[model samples]
Target: MDRHAPSTRCAVITPQLSKRAARAGSDRRSPEARLEEAVGLAAAIDLDVVFKGLVLLSEVKPATYLGSGKVEEIAGIVQAEEVGLVFVDAALSPVQQRNLEKAWSAKVVDRTALILEIFGSRARTKEGTLQVELAHLNYQRSRLVRSWTHLERQRGGFGFLGGPGETQIEADRRQIGERILRIERDLEQVKRTRALHRTSRKRVPYPVAALVGYTNAGKSTLFNRLTRAEVMAQDLLFATLDPTLRAVDLPHGTRVILSDTVGFISELPTQLVAAFRATLEEVIEADVILHVRDISHPDTEAQAADVRDVLTELGVDPEAGGRVVEVWNKIDLLPEDERDRMVNTAARADATDRPTLVSALTGEGADGLLDRIESLITAGRVMLTVTLPAEDGEGLGWLYRIGEVMEREIGEDGLMRASLRILPERVDLVKRRFGAAQVRTEV
Candidate 1:
């Protein structure tokens, strides 16, 4: 938090447990990729990675997660490198974390804690900050160990994570519990406000299109290309924490409200997922969902599976037919031959199951992507024509507000005739309000 303070010397240790553990957990990513991801997460928070290693674990130890010899080896590295913090790239229990800190004489944080810390730093909007804070408190509530050991000397502590050890661990937990409830209430209000905003957008001509994907998958780049908005599209993990919305006009004059949301990662902390549900509901309410992927990455399939898991957890059926679309981004980094092959494959696939291959960086294939999005947005929607008195311009304006005004005519009889494209849910409302001269159905 202090800009003038020195950077924390850090070490990242990814424990590659047995294949049995991997199979049980559905973790198919290689240990090297996991180690690389852990390092990226460290760099996201500006931690100087003095040491990075992946340990092949025969089994997880309850005391320190690593074997005693490995723990001692890391202690030597920490002392020699002066590592102030060590990130264990796996979940650790309170006892394991404390023992590791004692062995290495450094602040020991697990993957979940490191992620919470990065989120704490990246959050800009008040809603995002609240969500991160709530997650931190929930995580810290379980860590009733050394951080709360200093009881005699009265001093300030982490806002909600620590409380001077005034009464005891239970009292600290009480404080965290109270903060959690308050944050939950505030997030509920945020959810309601978000729902109201969705309702308001439904009264407009634009449809909601939300971007969802794994972290650092070029989603923000694609978003910037489509909307021409600067939204901190970086290669770092969790670069953009808050949600951003911008209006994008499709090729056929149809406009859409595009949303850029926080990216999902493998093994995302459950506390974060629970706390950010309000923010993630954007994907659920989206008229169209774009599942962007860094198709060039070696672990692209695994990354995609992780994202779908999160989507399923959020109550969105990833395979439920039409709402979700796969966007294979970052083709600019691919070999020309592979790129051509990918394009051909996409071209050969069935329309319903086809995925868009694009380079969000170079704007390659973006137009076609837009066309696909527009088609999906207008798919199965209703079409109707209404006639109104030319003097009743208010009714015409109302139609323009809610529906896509495709064709408009002013007749010699002083009556205005207009045709519209609207979501199926609003078809009945349009019929009841307009008393349309003719009604048509796309389905």
Candidate 2:
């Protein structure tokens, strides 16, 4: 075995800062829970956490992120404990990262860098890799000061310009800029391909339902349950980084395309949102949306709000004006009494449009969710009855293709009569094909 296998051991430190009472209240989640989530996320990407701590940065001296005394204390702990990496769960300026690494003699990363690393490691598809690379370059462009010592100067002809000792930061930035342009060109191609695919789906007139929720809120779990595909559903932040689409057959034999999208979260870095715009466009184009929630969590309500905030930023109306459904997922984790109380409350109140509660892990109430989706899709269908000549099978075939055939009968005049619920556009098509005399009932 290689002696230099990837080091898994790491430590986390969250610096304390004071804010207004309302701001603190809004972030009432315990630091322990946040640390646990961070650790869980690291483990999912194969990191072995050895230590975790919290420091108060408000009183720190010299450095804005880490005080000199606190830095010395952490350095001693890392040296004694043999920790390979230290993760600070807050944003740190490039200068702060360099200073902290120099003091601790270990790799130091902040929240943004850690997230970029995770995205780098998890990106699987070509477009995903390109997006990650672009984001990484954009982030690195700001932190070029971290790697200034590695640059070299050209020999002979151009050596006099910089005395043969140019900083590597300039070269790195140039290379990164070139790579970003290449990635942008490649992504443009991907965008065109995706647009073409969307056009094809639209021609079929299939309504789209997109899944959006907080990370690890069982959005992927519910998607897997409904679509029957393994989509890397794990209890980690940003587990599913790419958008996936599948054809889902409703209870009424109607087929619609369902899209599973990247999960949302609080303070999702603006850079990331801009980077993943291509992937998030799936949510924007969806006909209906499912806001999945982990109802069993103590911060369930807050989580819901966080998701809504992200959607609104993306221009999705939560009220959906009747186009969105709130899916309260993970009911299996709730106690029997709590579940009963919630179900009763949903029945009595029209608030939240009476969210549908289901255990995506156990397949509980899945049928009810399917029914709700079908109702939403078919709500605008109009009932119609029409008669066609026996030889004109095209009209009947079109009905079966575009509408749900509710009933059919043989008329005394050897004509085929049928009652159907069809989309308004398809109803017009039917009238154009069979004339007004063939139409008998319209509701």
- Pairs that clash in candidate 2: 151-168
Off by over 4 Å in 1: 2-5, 21-23, 145-148, 151-167, 424-443
The TM-scores of all predictions, comma-separated, are 0.92, 0.87
Task: Kindly report the root-mean-square deviation of model 1 from the true structure over all alpha carbons.
Answer: 4.2
Give the lowest summed-lDDT range of ten residues in model 2: 147-156
The worst-scoring run of ten residues by lDDT in candidate 1 lies at 146-155
lDDT of 1 by residue, 344-370 (tens): 988898888799988999999899999
What is the Å distance of residue 157 in model 1 from its true position?
26
Query: For residue 346, what is the lDDT in candidate 2?
Result: 73
What lDDT score goes with residue 106 in model 2? 88
CA lDDT, every model vs. true structure: 0.87, 0.78
